[model samples]
Target: MFDVQHLSYQAGRKPLLRDVSLQARPGELLAIVGANGAGKSTLLRLLSGDVAPSDGLVQFDGQPLASIPAAMLARRRAVLTQQHTLSLAFRVQELVLMGRYPYFRGQPSAHDYAVVADALATVGLSALAERSYPTLSGGEQQRAQLARVLAQVWEAELGFLLLDEPLTGLDLNHQHHTLDVARALVQRGFGVVAVLHDLNLAAQYADQVLVLRQGAVVASGVPAAVLTAAHIEHAFDIAVELLPHPSLDCPLIVPRPRAGVGAAFSL
Candidate 1:
């Protein structure tokens, strides 16, 4: 399990993340949600080991994450950051193969290629393996990047996947597709933590929810217990109504109507 202890982070003198703690377990999807500057991304970075906490501890399976060697950590957990920018004209398959860099010394073996193939298939991009990455549409590009990260942790029996704002610019279909991949990993005994902006999606898909407000944890628990109307209003400063989903066993979060809303009429 991934564990934390009073995790606090700072940038120079500004406290970006206050004392926070949570446990992310295998076979579960943890969704981190909050407003724009609520430290959601900063907390993800700390969990990814990309930055050190000012005062706290991040552990995987009872071992200090800081002590784990870089290569071993890469093999154990794969992180897909918010940014996916590639200017070069590289084939999509070649880009996905970059995830295998930690396992091979000089050149990737046939097994690495096989892994890449599986990763591509997992993201529903097997047909676009030869296409240049920059030529694909935005959603397809995100899927390619997802394949890259999945290739990184393909070999681990118990691994972790950390995604930061993975569905930011995608269409609705791609957003669900991304979460589908994360859910698949959870079924395979991999821990998945995602920083998300959609609370309804979180309520529908996540097994656990961590709500943040201005760098502190406002609430954390199952979505039914943590995503109440009061908590939503308190953290996001907007009124929302919690309704039962028609087909799913989760709450359907609907924001309350506000005044001065613009709508096209006479269609």
Candidate 2:
């Protein structure tokens, strides 16, 4: 299990996260939702050990995150950030193969190759394996990056995948597909904590939801409890109506125009 206790972060005298505590268990998906600049990504960085907390603790399977060796941490957890830039040209397959670097060092074995192929197939990028990374479209690139992370912890006994705004460039079909892939990982006993903007997707797929506002946790619980109309309105500062999903029992959020506002006016 991944556990965080009173986690907080500060940036040059400014607080970015405050007294945040949450737990992500294996075989479950924890979705973090909030408005832009709510510190959702900051919290993900803390959990992934990309940044140290200003106060409190983060532990994976009872081991302090700070105490874990970099190579061992790489094997146990993988992170897919919102943006990636590559100055050097590399093929998609080569980028995915990089995930196996911690295990294989400079040389890759047959198993590493097999894992890369499987990851490419999992992200629906098998046909683009030989293509250059920069040649792919934004969404395709995002998918390829996900495949890389997938290959990283594919064989770990206890793994955690931290995704920050993973659906950024994905289209509708790929958006659902990506979340479905994350759900599939949960079934295999891998913990996933995704920073998501779409509340409906979180409702449909998450076992637990954490809502943040102004760098603080406003709510945390099952989707049905944390995604209430009041919570949505408060967190996003927008009026919305909650309705049941046509097929699923989860809540569907439909943004409503503010009172006395013209249709032409943007919310």
Candidate 3:
């Protein structure tokens, strides 16, 4: 399991996260939600060891994150950020192969290539493996990046996948596909934590939800418990109606029209 205690991050005189504590275990998906500047991404960074917490502890399994070597850490965890800018004209296959760097160094073995191919197939980009990454559409590029991350820890038994707004450029179909992919990983005993903006998607797929307001955890529990109308209003400052999903045993959120607002034609 991945555990964090009293996690806090500060930049200069400003604090981004304060006294945050959470745990993500294998076979479950933890969804982190918050409004802009709520430090959702910052928390992911802290957990991924990309940035050190000003005060707190992060541990994977029984080892402190800071004590693990970089190469060893790469083997156990994979992170997909919100945005990636690639200027090179590398093919999609080559980009995904980069994930195997820790294992292959410079010379890739047959098993490494096999892993790359499997990763590409997992993201539904097997046909486009020869295409240039820079030439793909925004959503396609996002999937390529995801494939890279998946290939990183494909062989690990206990691994963590941390994604920050991974659905940014994906279309509706691909968005569901991506979340389904994450969910599938959990079934294989990998802990998946994602920063998601879409509450409904989180509600549908996540086993646990962590709501953040101004960098502090406002609530954490199953979607039905943490995604209450009251908590939504408190964290987002917007009115919403929560109802049970018709086909799924989860909450479905719908925006409530303001009292004075009318239809566009009525106005």
Candidate 4:
């Protein structure tokens, strides 16, 4: 479990996050939602221990995040950032093999290879296992990165996956497929936190939702409790109407045009 308390971050004189506290348990998915620069990626960076917070604490499984040894932590948490730039020509399988680097001394063992194969299969990349990373399309490369991270923490008893805008570059089908992989990880007792942009996807898949606005938490709870029309309008400064989803058990968010805005679209 992740126990964050009074977490705050400051860059020079600018406060990016303030007094944020939240807990995420294993076997669940936590979705962080906010507008651009709402401190969403900043929160993930703090959680991943990329930078020390100005104030507060982040504990993973009851241990301070900084206390965990770097080698051990590599196997316990895997992060997929919003962008990937690989100019080299490594084979896809070789790229995925990097995730297992911490597990080996000089060379990867047979078990590591087996794990990479499983990870590739999990992300629907087995067919492209030998393709060069630079040759695959954008969405395929994204899935390859997913496979890499899965190979990292595949065997941990306590694990977490941090994804920042994981849906970027994914097609409609692949987007849902990516989240499905996340849900499957939760079933295996890995806590998953993803920074998401789409509200409807959050309502459909998130077990807990934390909404941020201007560096402060506006709301945090189950989707039904936190994703009300009023809260959406407050956090995003946009008018929206919430309606029951046609089939799912969550609300469907529909954006409403601002008053006097439609006339601008008249032909």
TM-score of each: 0.95, 0.97, 0.96, 0.96
lDDT of each: 0.93, 0.94, 0.93, 0.94
Pick by TM-score: 1 or 4, better one: 4
Please give the lDDT score at residue 31 for candidate 1: 99
Model 4, residue 161: C-alpha shift (Å): 0.6
Tell me the tens digit of each residue's lDDT in model 1 across 30-127.
Answer: 99999999999999999888999999899988999899999889998999998877768899999999999999989899999999999999889999
Off by over 4 Å in 1: 261-267
RMSD of each: 2.5, 1.8, 2.0, 1.5
Candidate 4 C-alpha lDDT tens digits along 28-140: 99999988889999999988989999999999889999999999889889999887877789999999999999899899999999999999999899999999999999899
* Number of colliding residue pairs in each model: 0, 0, 0, 0
Candidate 3's C-alpha runs over 4 A off are 259-267
Q: Between the candidate structures 1 and 2, which one is better when assessed by TM-score?
A: 2
Model 1's TM-score against the true structure: 0.95
lDDT per residue (tens digit) for residues 1-267 in model 3: 888999999999899999999999999999999999999999999988999999999998879999999998999889999878777899999999999998976699999999999999999999999999999999999999999999999988878899999999899999999999998999999999999999999999999999999999999999999999999999998899998799999889997878755666593
Looking at model 4, the pairs that clash are: none
Best candidate (score: TM-score): 2
